[model samples]
Target chain A: MAGRTARSERAAGTGEVLLAVAERLFAEHGVFAVSNRQISEAAGQGNNAAVGYHFGTKTDLLRAIVRRHAERIEALREEMLERTGDSASVRDWVAVLVRPGTQHLAELGSPTWYARFGAQLMTDPVLRELMVDETFGPTIRRTLEGLNRCLPELPLPVRLERADMARNLMVHMLAERERALAEGAHTARTSWHAYATGLIDALTGLWLAPVTTDG
Target chain B: MAGRTARSERAAGTGEVLLAVAERLFAEHGVFAVSNRQISEAAGQGNNAAVGYHFGTKTDLLRAIVRRHAERIEALREEMLERTGDSASVRDWVAVLVRPGTQHLAELGSPTWYARFGAQLMTDPVLRELMVDETFGPTIRRTLEGLNRCLPELPLPVRLERADMARNLMVHMLAERERALAEGAHTARTSWHAYATGLIDALTGLWLAPVTTDG
Candidate 1:
């Protein structure tokens, strides 16, 4: 029993190490550019087929990374949903969706390659469609349903139009933030928090303007 | 003089043919994935180096295609400015910027690759920055100046923020439209036109909202 426990702990440690190496390399060189051998080598395992032995393939490894990241996002979403009860406004819902992403990115000690990987995925139709369907589709659907309920006076098309616009704006801002960080804009002064707050406030105003009918 | 005219016309025709083929190939495969050989072969030019002969390199070819499209945009901007007559409403200016893009895409008859190219460019820092500097920089600056003069109550950051959001929304709409088209949706039924008009109206409302508060 002691030996089995020790082996399992070692296995968990190895898995963590593999993920750490994969995240950095994937972020730096993109999913297509990085190889399984490189992940193993970088992890200091020095085993030729370590990635396959563990994660199966490069594509699988990418999916794994995405899955791991999605869990964090899912948790954030759940927490936000819990905080935002039935009487939440459109602006409140927008805040819940946008804040978690920016906050998660801010808290990470090192800049991960996920953002770059994501940028590449935007151009790749297959991966792009899959990621959208899996990650954003359900979340957006739920958010929109909540928003529509909150703003029933707004036309369905109008609500969808605003939601789509807000979503695109968020995606573009995230990409822009990644570019700014990559270009050496000091995170201390121009933190993701400042950027996210500005963007969310602007987008929230845009999305909520239609329902308010004052605009 | 007749011979010179003939040669010039042939050169122009060749350039057109090369661009036509290059655009088709680039749309089918991405800019990085397609090769000069494929473009030349598809264009029915015997020499695989025909792309190089006519346009220097693949990057130059891509630039030429973008420049061709941009010329139409520039012309539209000039026409809009002329129509505005120095005292345009905020809505009028937004309409000027939004209408031309929607019309151009509708009329261009080119494959949706241009839209995809644009989506890729937005996420690409080098290309995005250059595009803002060269193509959009002067026009945006002038438009903002005009808007500020017309609507002085708005804050500078608010103006800049709305402008960025408008541009980002436009790009996203184009990309989404292309996807819809690919999925067999008719252009008339697509949400792009409605979305653009909605966005323009929203921005106009935002711009005019602060005025009402002061009054």
Candidate 2:
């Protein structure tokens, strides 16, 4: 039993190191451009097939990276949802939607790779479906339902369109902020908290904005 | 002289074909993942080095693709600006901001690649500078000035933040719509013109949204 535990722990450690290395490399190089072999080599594995051995395939490796971040983000949102309850205002619900991401990034501190990596997945057709399946499951669905419950009067199509807009804005803007933070460049908002505040405010307006033209 | 003119025209024709092929491939595949050799070969050039011979670098090729569209977008916005000429309504200025790209995309008809291609460039760090320099030059500056003139009372930081949000929403949303069209999937708005109208409405609300927390 002791020997088995030791071997399992070592395997877990290797997985963690591979995930970290893969995330950083994917954030630096384009996801499709970086091979499984390169990620394994970067993780200091003597066996080039280490990634295959550990993660199965490149897509599986990408999912592992996303799942790592999504798990934390979901937990953050779940806690926020507890605080919010059914009485949540539009801004509160938007906070539920946006804060998990910014907060997670803030908690991760500098040189984080999740935002850039997530943004790329959000753009890729196959990878986006994988990410949405992983991240936008139970917790996100509940949050959106809560938000929609509050937005009872908005037209369905308009609501859907703005939701799409909000998601895009949230993902892409945070990606930009992350990139800026990594590069030590100037950002208009000083901190992640401030950035989320700005986003929630604008999104509040966006979600509540009157629909003029009907689709 | 006639033979030289014919040769130049033939070369220009090849360059145009290469640009079209490159844009489509870059849109379908991530920009960095697609090679100039692949682009040349995809364009049916016998020499795989044709991309290099025609365009000095990958960035140069990307720029050439952007320049091809920028000229058309610039002309469209110039016409719209002539009609707007310091209109104080936020929506009018927002229209000036949103219309040109969507209108250009609409004019390009179904399965256009520029939006997706441009969105990738917008997200990329090094290429974003090229996109802004090439596309965000004088006309955008003037439009922003006019938009600011309309909202003299809005806080500078809020204005800047909303501007960033608007740009992100515009680029990414158009990219999504473009992708959906390419895939023959459902989209909220049926036409690009309507899409711009929806964007302008949402942006008007976003820009005029009361600043909740002062930066």
Give candidates' CA RMSD values in order: 6.4, 4.8
List candidate 2 stretches off by more than 4 Å: A1-12, B1-12
Comparing only chain B with the true structure, the TM-scores of all models are 0.77, 0.92
| Backbone clash count for every predicted candidate, in the order shown | 1, 0
> Which of the numbered candidates is closest to the native, going by highest lDDT?
2
Weakest ten-residue segment in model 2 chain B by summed lDDT: B2-11
DockQ score for candidate 2 = 0.50
DockQ each candidate and list the results.
0.26, 0.50
Model 1: clashing residue pairs?
A27-A113
Candidate 1: residue B134 Cα off by (Å):
4.5
- TM-scores, all candidates, are 0.80, 0.91
